[model samples]
Target: MRLKETEPEEIKLNMTAMIDIVFQLLVFFIMTFKVVAMEGDFNIRMPLASQNQEESMDEDFPTIIYVQLAAGTNGNINSIIVDDDTTFSDTDMYSKLTQLVESKIAAEGNPEDSKETEVEFDIARELKYSYTVKAIEAVSGKVVDGQIKKLIQKIKFKDSTSF
Candidate 1:
């Protein structure tokens, strides 16, 4: 008998299948995955309308301002915030926001423009929903909804916070 060779055969891994799976998984995630913000304390119980409608409606518009409302420790809406720190209330709130809106319109250099941008509100979740609506209505003569068409001409209910 011939002398036996002790060398072992080399093993190889087929990466093409693994690479194809990885690429497939990547594409699958790209199609299925979505990125969204987490509104931890901020929440709203938006009611679902029973009326079935087309999905393409209200798809192109962009909102302007964002208003955040939270319940103060005293159980009253002691402050109204913008973005985060821009807080105001009473006359101050009205004046500041009004000025901000006015300035925004002015920035476009349109003196006779009646179009209003959106004002998203993050209000105290515990407060009666009417209270929040009333606050904005008191200012814009309407409630914030998509397009701000009714009372709030350019408003959107951004979110609400429990605290």
Candidate 2:
């Protein structure tokens, strides 16, 4: 007996289920999505050209104070030099620093004058971090009679390569 061969039928794919699954996934993601603010957004005001020019022409601008910290063999602060004139050792470093900073800005006679003054630190690369911090604290402020006295607000570090 001879067997008859049957032709193969075309397979049809149901797209409704696939479309539903895609729609479900899209809806889930949309429902779970959250809106967030961008980081580091700052509100800065730009000055006009005339104002900038006027400010630049002002001769009463404060001066820059240079403080150099030298390190010893043990990474400790060996000496503190201010403006190539005054030097304070580890024994009385902080007190002398505070006094020097106070005296420098004292001519202005206004506490706000300290804000106009800028301090640039030229610290040794090998100096101990603690000493660096202490030096910063010394010029930053002082506590007098149970009250905090604000000092120079503008502080910056000089490049180590320049030392």
Candidate 3:
């Protein structure tokens, strides 16, 4: 007996939906991607290692402001000293340092130019990290109304062993 043969079914894959989804994903990622500014983009000026003898002897040397932090027995900040004369406790460091920096800026007669002043931080090795950050913020100054006011743009970190 002869049996009738049936035709084989054809199987096909639909790639249109997959291609559309892939394109959508690519568009979404492209739209959401962010370009970040690099650390060198701020145009920060670093101190030069050498200078002319005449320029070094000039009386208009950059005003150096010293911030010394003394650590207590427990590794906390015991006292804060500014220019070796003014002193502030841990709680009053912010206000006092801000006032001192503001006064220094005012004394310069040119608040717009922050290059004339230099800040040096003499931090102790045992001091807490938070204290060091607070000290830096104090010397950096803050915005007062709408304008951006800076005390000193040149900041130097001395050797911790010097403290």
Candidate maximizing TM-score: 3
Q: Return the clash pairs for model 2, or none.
A: none
Winner of 1 and 2 under TM-score:
2
Where is model 1 poorest over a 10-residue stretch in terms of lDDT?
47-56
Which candidate number has the best lDDT?
2
TM-score of every prediction relative to native? 0.44, 0.60, 0.62
lDDT of 1 by residue, 69-145 (tens): 66756556666677665777674565465555556555756534434345667667676664575556544532246
Listed per model in order, the count of residue pairs whose N, CA or C atoms clash below 3 Å is: 6, 0, 0
lDDT of 2 at 139: 86
Superposed on all Cα atoms, the candidates' RMSDs to the truth, in angstroms, are 18.4, 12.9, 8.5
Which one wins by lDDT: 2 or 3? 2
Once model 2 is optimally superposed onto the true structure by TM-score, how far is the C-alpha of residue 140 displaced, in angstroms? 0.4
Q: What is the C-alpha lDDT of each candidate?
A: 0.56, 0.81, 0.76
Q: TM-score of the candidate numbered 3?
A: 0.62
